[model samples]
Target: MQNASKITEERINKGSLLALAPIGVFLVLFMGSGIITGDFYKMPALIAFMVAAGVALMINPKESLQNKIDIFCKSAGDPNILIMVIIFLLAGAFGSVAKAMGAVDSTVNLSLSILPANLLVTGLFLVVCFISISMGTSVGTVSALTPIGIGISQKTGIPLELLVAIIVGGAMVGDNLSMISDTTIAAANTQGCELKDKVKMNFFVVLPAAIISIIIVAIMTSGYQSASTETYSYEIIKVIPYLAVLVGALAGANVFVLLAGGVLFAGAVGLFTNSIDLWGFIGAVSEGMAGMQELCILVMIVGGVIGLIKHNGGIDFVLNYITSKIKSATGAKIGIALLSSIIDLCTANNTITIITAGPLAKEIGEEYDLDPRKIASILDIFASCWQGMIPYGAQILTAVGIAGVSSVAVIKYLHYPIFLLIFGIISITVDFSALKKKKTH
Candidate 1:
C-alpha cells in the first residue's frame, strides 16, 4: 500500500511537456484551419475541442482507458464547471426574455438619449466597471451588460465586436479588484493577507490601466457618428428588468437568485406589456437556452481536456519549470505572475487559477521576504489579465456568445487587459512599497 501511494505521488510530479500537446493540437485545428481558410467560422470551436479531447485520451497509454475516461468525465462534471453551465443557461434565459420584451431596445435608446455619440463607448466602459465592481463577478457583469451592448451597436453602427470587447475589458477591472470576488478571496487567503490590504495593493496596480483604457476608448469613438440620424424613443417600463437586475447585483444578492429573478420579472413584464404572451415567453426561454448549447458543450470539453493535461502532469511541468528559475525577489514576483497567467490560460478560469497557484506563491513570497499583499495582488491581476483576453475564457466567450461576434474580432479591441498586463509588470519592476514607506516617514 505504501509503495502504491509513493508511485502515485511520483507520477503526479513527473512533469511532462508532451502532456500539453493536446492544447497545441486544438489551437492548430481551430486557429490554423481558420487562418488557412481566411474565415474563422470555417472551423467550429466545438469540433476542435472534441478532437483535442481525443488527443488527451491518447496521451497516457500506460493508464487504463477506463481510468482516463473516468478522469475526463469527472472534470466535465466538476462543481465549478457545472455552476458555470447553470449560469450560462440562466443568463441566456434572462437576456432572451428581456430582449423579447423590448428591454434591450428601451435601455439602449435611453442611454443614447443621455450620452453623446462620441462618449458612448467610454461611458459603457465606466458603467460596466462600476457594476462589475459592485457585483464582484466578471461573468455576471458580462452576461447582464452584453445585450445592451449589442443593442447600442445596432443603433449606433459602432462595430458590435468592439463594443463587446470593451464590455469584457471593463468587467475584468472589477474582477481583479472587487473585495468579494472569488479570485480576490482565494488569493488573499492563500497568501495569508488581509483582504483589504490586497484590495489596496491591487487598486494601485489596476488604476492606471483603467484610466488609460477609458482614454483610449474615448479616443476610439471620438470621430464616430451615429449610423441613424433620427431621434431615439424609449419606454421606462421596458427598462425595469435591467434596472432590477443591476440593483440586485449591487446589493450583493446571490448570482443564481438574481438571474432567476431577472428571468421571471422579464417574463412578467413581457406579459403585462403584451410584448409577449404566456406561450411566447416559454418559447423565448427555450430558444435562449438552446442558443447557449454550443458554449456549454465547449466549456465541458475544455474542462475535460484540461483535466487530462493536469493528470498527465502538464500543469506540474509548467509549475516546476517556473519555480526553478526564481533567483531574486523580482524573479519570484514574475514567476508568480507567470504561473497564474499560464494556469489561467489552461483552465480558462481566474478563480481556479489563483487557487491552484496561491500556495506556491505564498512559499515563494516567504522565501524572498516579499509582501503577502503584493503576492495576492499579483495573483489576482495576472490571472484577470489573461482571463479577460483569452479567446476561450468564460468572460470573452460569454460576451461573444451574446453579441454574436467571433472571438478573434473581439480580441483585437481588448485594450484594458493588454494595459493591465503592462501595469502589472511595471508594478513589479518598480518598488511602490518603498515609495509608500517614504511617504509615511
Candidate 2:
C-alpha cells in the first residue's frame, strides 16, 4: 500500500512539473538561443511560447489533446493578461510617437545642456530614482529619462550603456521600495500588512543601497568633460505631455488613462506647433500601437501559460517542497527569499512575483516570529534585484535594445544593482546586526 501511495505521489509531482514546462521552453528556445546567437530579439518570444505550450499538452496524460488546447486558451485569455497587453500597446505607441516627434532628442539635449557636466551621471541617476520612487514604475521612469540619459552619455563622454545602467539601477530601487509601487501593493496585500509599514521597514534597507549607488556614480563621473553640441530649439509646450504623464501617473491615475491623456496632450501640442498635421498625428498613434503589438501578444501568451501552470498546481508543488524543508526560523526566511526570487525570475514581473510569493512568505513569517515588515522587504528587494539583472526581463531587455549592446555586456556594468543584492543578502543573513544594535541603544 505504501509503495502504491509513493507511486501516486510521484505521478502527481510529474504532472505538476509538466504544467511548468512553458517557462522552461521560453528560457531555452527564446532566451537561450538569443544568448547563443548574440541577439536577444532574434527569437520571437511568441514562437517559444507556441512550441513550449504545445509540449505542455503532450505532457498531460489525463486530458485529451483538445481539452489541453482549451485549457491553454482559457489561461491565455484572462483579464489581467489582457490588461497587460493593453498597457504594453499604449506604452509602445506613446514611446514611438514621442520619439518620432523629436520630443526625445529635444528633451535629451535640453537636460544635458542644463545640468553640469561633472554632475551629469549622478544627477540623471538621482532624477530617475526620484521619479520611479514617486511614480512607482520603472518602465515609466526609463521612458521619461532614457532620452536624457542617452544625451548625457554623448555630452559627458561617459559610456552610454553604463549611463543607462545607472538610470535603470536607480529606477529599480524605487520600484522595489516605493509605497505606491505595484510591487509594494502586491507585497502588502499578500502579506496583510499596511503599505506605509512595509515602506517604513523597506526604506531603511533600500536607502543605504540608494545612497551607495549615487556616491559610486558621482565618483565615477568626477572627471567628465562636456562636449559642445549644435543648439536645437523645441517648443516648451511639447514638454507638457511628459510632465502631464508623470503627474497623472504619480497621482494614482490608471496607466491606460495616463497614456491616453499623454497621447492627446502631445498630439495637440504637435498640431498647434505644426510639428504634425491632424492626420499625421493620427498616423503616428497607429504606428505606435503597431510597434508594440508584438510585445503585447507575448504578454498575453505568457500570462495564459502561467495561469494554467498555477491552476495545475505547479506553484503549489514548489511552495510545498520549500515549506517542507523549513527546519528553523533563519531557514524559513532564506527559503522565502529564494522562493520570491525564483518566482520573479519565472514571471519577469516583480509585482506578479510578489503577489504569488506574499501569502506563503507571510505564513512562514508567522511560524518563525519574523517581522512581516522584514518579510515584505525581502520580497521586494530580491524581486527587484532579479528583475534588474535578468537578461530576459523587461528592464534589462529595454536597456539592451536602447543601448545597442548585448544584455550580457550591460550586466557587467550594473555595479549598483549587483552590490544592492549583495548588501541585501548580507543584511538578512547577519540578522541585520548593525541595525539591531542601533535600535537597542
User: CA lDDT of 184 in candidate 1?
Assistant: 65
**What is each predicted model's overall lDDT from 0 to 1?**
0.77, 0.68
Clashing residue pairs in candidate 2 are 75-304, 76-304
State how far residue 209 of model 1 sits from its true place (Å).
Answer: 3.1
> Would you give me the overall lDDT of model 2?
0.68
TM-score of each: 0.64, 0.69
On residues 1-441, what C-alpha lDDT tens digit does candidate 1 reach at each position? 123233334445567999988777876776677568655446776787799899999997999999999999998887766766776677678777887988767765665567666677788888788667644578877987898788778877788998999999999977776644567666776676665667778888788898999888888877766564657788889888877876775566766788798899999999999999999999999988897788677767777887888899886675555545555678879988888888777656787667556756775675566788889889998999998988877898889988889999999999999999999999987754432411111
Worst 10 residues of 2 by lDDT: 432-441
Q: Which candidate has the highest lDDT of all? A: 1
Candidate 1: where are CA atoms >4 Å away?
1-13, 116-207, 215-230, 327-418, 424-441
lDDT of 2 by residue, 221-286 (tens): 788866755464655666666667666655667667777777777787777877888888888889
